[model samples]
Target: MAKSPLFERGMVTRRAVLGDKHVDGATARKTDFDDDFQTLITEGAWGSVWSRPGLPRRERSLLTLALLAALGHEEEFAMHVRATANTGATAEDIKEALLHVAIYAGVPAANAAFRIAKQELAKLQEAAE
Candidate 1:
């Protein structure tokens, strides 16, 4: 089947935020059973929503990080935290977003997110050195 325009657009956006290596790793591990699900995220989440022009990528990154933190989606939150480098979301922005998560989503969740974010940020910094 021909690839959808949304899928194509999503791949571009996804690679931009998540980086080529991360996206490639996921693609490389994709199985037949996950094909449909992967398409849905690429088209719906990355393409339809993230590709919208209304919000800046930085703002979107903050929102995504906050929501992931609130929901205690540790893994996804960590991934998005790393994505902030490309999304233009600074560490300060993440700190502020997690403060919101603390007030609304509870201290424990925000605390956990802070830990993950710190770890990811350290790894990123280490990579740069």
Candidate 2:
């Protein structure tokens, strides 16, 4: 039923988890030049690891957000922050994770993540209301 054991769920799980716009934007950016890189991440990060069943989706989402935040990946952190809502992690959970990141990853990284999360979360909430 599933194609990729890595992304076995196909783009469905990833899209539902990460949002269509973000995933589509990423897909649209794929190029023959970057085909290898694209395949690597698609099969490795998105398909392989994220597809694993060990951790609950929310826990995986939380860990991903924290890692992205701490590593100073602003856009990625922002995207994952948005994904948290779908993963059963609340906005408050994101706040807590970022606060922890601030303490561990330094203020600048956390500050940027906060701003991004704030903007994205606000957008998501506005859509809901």
Best by TM-score: 1
User: What TM-score would each prediction reach against the true structure?
Assistant: 0.98, 0.85
Off by over 4 Å in 1: none
Best by lDDT: 1
Q: lDDT tens string, model 2, 7-126?
A: 545366677688889789988998889967766777777676777789888888988988998998987887787787788988888889889999998889888888998999999899
The global C-alpha lDDT for each of the candidates, from Candidate 1 onward, is 0.96, 0.81
Q: What local lDDT does model 1 show for residue 39?
A: 98
* Model 2 worst lDDT run, 10 consecutive residues: 1-10
Report the lDDT of model 2 for residue 128.
88
